[model samples]
Target: MNSALEILTKYWKHDAFRKPQEAIIASVLEGKDTFALMPTGGGKSICFQVPGMMKEGICLVISPLIALMRDQVQNLQNKGIKAIALTGGIHSDEIIDLLDNCQFGNYKFLYLSPERLQNDWILERIKNLPVNLIAIDEAHCVSQWGHDFRPAYLKIVQLKEYFPKVPFLALTASATPRVKEDIMVQLKLDNPQIFTKSFYRDNIAYMVFETEDKLHLLQQILQKNPQPSIIYVTNRKSCNETVHQLESLGFTATFYHGGLSSKDKEKHMQLWMNEKVQVMVATNAFGMGIDKANVKTIIHLHLPQNLENYYQESGRAGRNGDKAFAVLLNNPSDILHAEAQFISVLPDKKFLNLVFTKLCNYFQIAYGEGIDEQFSFNLNHFCTKYSFPTLKTYNALQFLDRQGIITLSQEFSEKITLQFIIPSKEVIRYMSLNPNDEEILLTMLRTYPGIYDMQTAFNLQLIAKKSNHTENEVLSLLQKLKEKNIIEMMAKSNDATITLNEIREDERTINRVSKYLEAQNKLKTEQLQAVLQYSKDTKSCKNKVLMQYFGESLAADCGICSYCISKNRKKQNPETVSDKIVELLKIQDFNSRDIQKLTKLPKDDVIFALQKLLEDETISINSNNLYSLK
Candidate 1:
């Protein structure tokens, strides 16, 4: 076997490991379990991947994030490494074939979703693979106490029975002490060597600006910051609105959300990634697996509900160890609105049951009739039909899915893509052989080329229109074609994939997870309060606050933070009234006395504000020495 360093240098072209990576890899190579708590951009993948490359058998990676898996797999493949991800919506036969390839096909890595572990057939097949080390990414999900918990992770511990000798490596960027303990116990990791890199990001200047005019402040920040920044918003409307606001100001900006089609998402992401656009105003969905290193600024327009999310997103910045800012713009309304949207309407038992019943009614599934059945759920249609708040109802569905009541995937089918497994002549022959499915098949073939060799992205609506069929008809035909092997279709995922986990029961049974729901609600509230406190905090060093939240410590204040800089500025100036006035004057033309009336500052402060504005040349003193825009 090649040494780990040799494999790393050979594939990654790196002569050195990033901080704790070497030690974590050493533990895995020594056949000892490990909990690697590296930061978001801390080269977590290299820790497990290098060891896997050096090992004899394939590394089995259990990831909860589909996007992460896809990105890693693509990156590996780009590096001439053999890796495959068995994500959702895959046909069983394809999964078996992929697993078989991993076993005997010399595949280096296998990335799969945690949900896939529930399949008995898959487990049986996994037993046959020469799996060396099992690496669980996002291991925090196993901890119900963690922010992004997934119950499917509880089933991962059973792997020990099949691969008793294989070492386990659990990796996460954000996990509290409680979450860490839960992960070790739940995964049954055997005396794992725990490696935690210090959470102190000395290079990141943590900033919290309490401002009522967030948009104006945002514009100012954009003007000051360098290119290729990210603006995270709370909702789709805000994302689009921010993009529009930036565009109106002549900035190259775009928006991304889960609602966008796969092509559109990829296009927008690529545009931003390639720096074709200077900024990407996106929801929480846009930043995983991004390693652009030079993200100079990340402004959270709304307060993140928890520090974990804030830390992870902030960690995205300053990855290059250069000066970067993780800024949160908040006002009284921002926090209050965040609380109401995130915590208040978290769907109690009545609300959950109401949504659940409406869901059943909408699907026309009678009680006890739709067990294990699947349906394409459109949240907008359901909410419009029942006149429910989109966000609250969606959160209710998520909670239900978490409780194993139903499975809701909002963008599942949107990522589903397909390719023709056969040649064009064979496709035409098969089209001739089957008269009923020709239109859709021909439409697909005519619509996209290179489908024979690679996965081609597809749109059911477009295909349906070209074939003169409804979306359902197009989907059924595609699946039927896939079954016949004329074309291979990725399992459809765009609609909410709702699997009635159990036969539809009455309100009493559906609300059985009420206590669990209440606990979740409580946890969510606590999480919100934690972030709120962080936002409201003025006495603590921002870096210290973040470090303590993650159970770490910093030797001293990161001097680059807003608070530390403000303190130093205060010591130097002792009076900031002039600075505040300059800010408003820069926004528009304002005479000094009018600025005083608008700002209601003392005469001395107003004179100071005017003098500062003139000195800074932000506003010119006219013939009368009154301040005006330069």
Candidate 2:
């Protein structure tokens, strides 16, 4: 195989592989199961991608995030590489055709979500494909102990038996030692090579300021560094609230969370990526697989659930390797609120059982009825209308879905139009013959290029404008054409779907799912509490604390950090004005006159401070007499 260096330069446009990527790729290329622990922005995708290119057969990548699949496939397509994403967005008939293509087509990679594994026909077809590698992304979800664990991921472990000799590569940007080992065991890797990278960024200055005036602090940070940025909150409601606050501050910003429709989410993402909006106030759901590298800052309006997530979010900043900041604006009550969030996940078995039962009934699935059906789900609306505890219900549903009861997708449904029908000339001639429908017919032809190349639906408004008609007129004409078989139209996405496994005779299955749900709640609560401890732990260096949470051991303090500065200042001097002034001068060099003004002491005291500073050589005065840090 060619060197990772050669691959890096030839395709990825990087001078060299990032830390651990080279080692990880080498291991996987040698046909070893590999577990890669990288923080966000750690070049995790390249580990599997580079190897996929070198291998002989298609690398089947299992990913939980559908949005990430679309983005990666699109990026690969842009590079003129053949890749496909088999997700819930496609129709059953199309999925069959795609599987056939993968089996015989020249596709190098196929990306799929974990939920798709439940299809028996798909699994039957997969066994015949020449799969060379199985890359499990976000592999932490396979572990019961992982924070974002999915029950659907358990089926992933069974894939090894089906393709016993195919090498496996499990990758994740966040995983503790416990989660790491769990991933290895769950994937059933045979003597896997593990690559763990240090979770530290030298250029990212960490700041957590206690503030009551959050809007003011946010305003100051945005004004100070008005580059691309993200403000992360904990929930959808909070996401909107934070965006509203940022908007009121005269900043152009947008909000993103799991709650928005796919169309709106895509529009906002495009706006942010296109630089039409400089800020995106969102929840944790927004950052994964987002390739915008110029994000100069990431502000945490709420405490994240764990350091793994915190590290990943913070690492998104300064991706261009420039000096940036990860600021946390918190209040004293933040810890309490955080702790309350944790407790909300610590519900009892009875509570979980009630919620699970409601979910099965809410979806109108009798025992074992929704084995493989998929449907769209709206979390907040579902919880509010049904008067259920949202966090508890969400946890319960995740547990139930994991236990193979249903598929709960936490993604927005997207709207897509395909103008994938008739050639432009053919359409124009047909419209000419029907002069009464000419305006609407020509609108579709003019607005969508797909009409000339493939069968597809065009955006109603754009088509209307082109044909010199209103959106309604265009839609009516399209419907008429579709009924006459002259064209076809399909709206993009419906909600998530859950197929009941068919009516089961055993009532004990309910108890099994309930126990798992209760256990999940407790685990999530513990994870959130760990975050609270990280926020309030005063006895340790903040950076060290974050490192330790990610399962890293540090030998030294970050000398430039706030903790280091605070400690060094306290040890230097307290009673002596000279030492205090010297330390201040070292931090920020000031002229003797400016020192005099800042100290507000007598001229003699200022001179004494300057004399002490000069004696210590902590600072020096220029020939212009402007003092500066040495």
RMSD per prediction, one decimal?
8.0, 9.8
> Each model's C-alpha lDDT?
0.83, 0.75
- Candidate 2 clashes: the total is 31
Please, what are the lDDT tens digits per residue for candidate 1 over residues 70-184? 8899899999999999876555666777888988899999999777777787888888889999999999988889887777788999999999999999999999999999999
Cα lDDT tens digits, model 2, 224-321, are 99899999988888887888878888998998987676668889999998889889999888887786778888999987777668888888898888
Candidate 2, which segments miss by more than 4 Å at Cα? 1-11, 89-92, 345-347, 366-368, 378-381, 402-404, 411-509, 569-630
TM-score for each prediction?
A: 0.80, 0.76
Candidate 2 worst ten-residue window by lDDT: 497-506
Best-fitting candidate, measured by lDDT? 1
